[model samples]
Target: METSPSLAGPFALGTFSSGAGPAFPGLVAGGRVLDLSAHAPTTRALLERWDDVLPLLREAAAAPAGEWRPVAELRVHAPVEPRQIFQSGANYRTHVIDLAVAHEPAGGRPAEQVRAEVAAMMDRRAAEDQPYVFIGLPSSVTGPYDDVVIPSWCTKPDWELELAAVIGRPAFRINPDKALEHVAAYTIANDVTAREVVFRRDMPEIGTDWLRAKNAPTFTPLGPYLVPAAFLDPGELRVTLKLNGEVMQDESTKDMIFGVARLVSYVSQTVELLPGDLVLTGSPAGNGLHHGRLLRDGDVMEGTITGLGTQRNRCRDER
Candidate 1:
């Protein structure tokens, strides 16, 4: 039987992804350091005509040359710079649990108090049956290994590991069932937060606002690459987080209470989504601030997916 053309992975030609040793020379098989932003026009044309590029991506991943550059030498950029960056929060039960746990100690409240708050929110939401969601600005996104600025003013910055979808085409009022069709690919995102800034800027009477807390400058670090969804089984693939070389968050996409396609459909039903736009599906349970541990200077944060590859970032204090 002839192999299907879409049975392949995302492609970038460079000496990257090869572990240790000299990078494969010449244009390596994988563009570990792709220049997507450099050729925006060409990329838009390609996405519009993905069928033509599928075969090309297959050819590239199959063969690679030696003499690749150390990861530091490569120029990396955000995988997808859509018109907007949309995000949802607390879509997972694990995250909600962690939030309650994290806040209990700090809020100086008993565990029951935290549970009571969550229970009340859940009960009210159940009565109204509203799916909570919010927006994240595009300006917050930075490339893999990029610095997540620790603004001096913000005290409670945090990180959330999310599976984001890169839209393949313009989708407005699209049905949930057909949402997958509009997904161009999947990428990893670290939704950085400035907890203090968020509350101060957004909240009314000490209540938090989503924009200031979630959309701090250089708060979202993304990339490595937008892995074509076709290459991923969707059902499998472990999502893991490591801090300072120790595993902190380890979960799977399977844990997502609301899956990717459902999110795409839910948002598109109300908002007009454009090609290259991203939907940051909610994060898994384990997060530093969620556990009462905040990020400090000289810490390394790394995120890796089973098949999608890894994004390693070294944190530095913002000047």
Candidate 2:
């Protein structure tokens, strides 16, 4: 039996298209997909009317009396075309500590010493009550099962699987207590990175160059489906990723220094989050940097978060 967790709700939402047809919003339930093109058109439009559609979804899932098709018949896509992507960095305590310890110069200090220093620094960051968030272009996003093309210049390709919260309501400067109210659904996103170009060699003052380091075609592989926020809890979920069938990242959301609510609240203070915006909480422990095994050409990565579904992507060279 397939062991993947089912959607917490009776149905999930997705984008799909058949041969020679335009893509449409779909409601997935029990191996079947109900085309939602007539109701709200695209997935983004559906999310805009999420409050009204949510009740309709609950009612549809109870009986599924419409013209439902098998999920296997259509081509699945990265569920939503997000207008804005807010990515959190160093949000997970263990992931930060592990990276710091691994990247430390070998002869400089003991491994334990490096870990302790990093741990203390992370604690200070958490106590300060701010999250490090960055902006990402929507053009970098690709289908969940699509191929990731590792550019030739990227000698150190890495994977960071994260829990993505999709925004339903427009929010700006919202409090942490009200942040969850703006979240409509949850999905999966793999923030693939080219580690070498992350820091610019020419300019020390300019800091990170996210444009060249991260934004490449097919670098960000996103969701297979969107599970409603009402059905799942962002906290206490398990995030796991396997490379060539070997487990690399397996950790829980509990280790996050800044949970979903705090991260969302922090981001809203700076920008107005619109419908279909994505908030990507940082990855947990066990990334390629710590494993000492960067991605090779043709490598396959399968990532999963509890009740959100699994995303499997194959790597390809940009030749």
Model 1 agreement with the true structure over 204-256: per-residue lDDT tens digits: 67666787788777788876666677877665667788888888889887766
TM-score of each: 0.79, 0.97
Off by over 4 Å in 2: 1-5
For candidate 1, the clash count comes to: 13
Residue 202's lDDT within candidate 1 is 42
Clashes of each: 13, 0
> Per-residue lDDT for 254 in model 1?
76
- Locate the minimum summed-lDDT window of 10 residues in model 2: 1-10
- Candidate with best lDDT: 2
What is the per-residue lDDT of model 2 for residues 1-319, given as tens digits with 9 covering 90 to 100?
Answer: 1212466778899999988899999988888888889988889998998899899988887784899988778888899999999999988999999988887776988989989999999999988997899998899999988899998888999999999999999989999999999999999999998888887879969888888777898888988898999998889899999999999999999999999999899999989999999999999999999999999989999999999888889999886
Native-referenced Cα lDDT, model 1: 0.66
- lDDT scores of the candidates, listed in order: 0.66, 0.90
Candidate 1 Cα outliers beyond 4 Å, as residue runs? 1-45, 59-73, 104-109, 112-130, 200-207
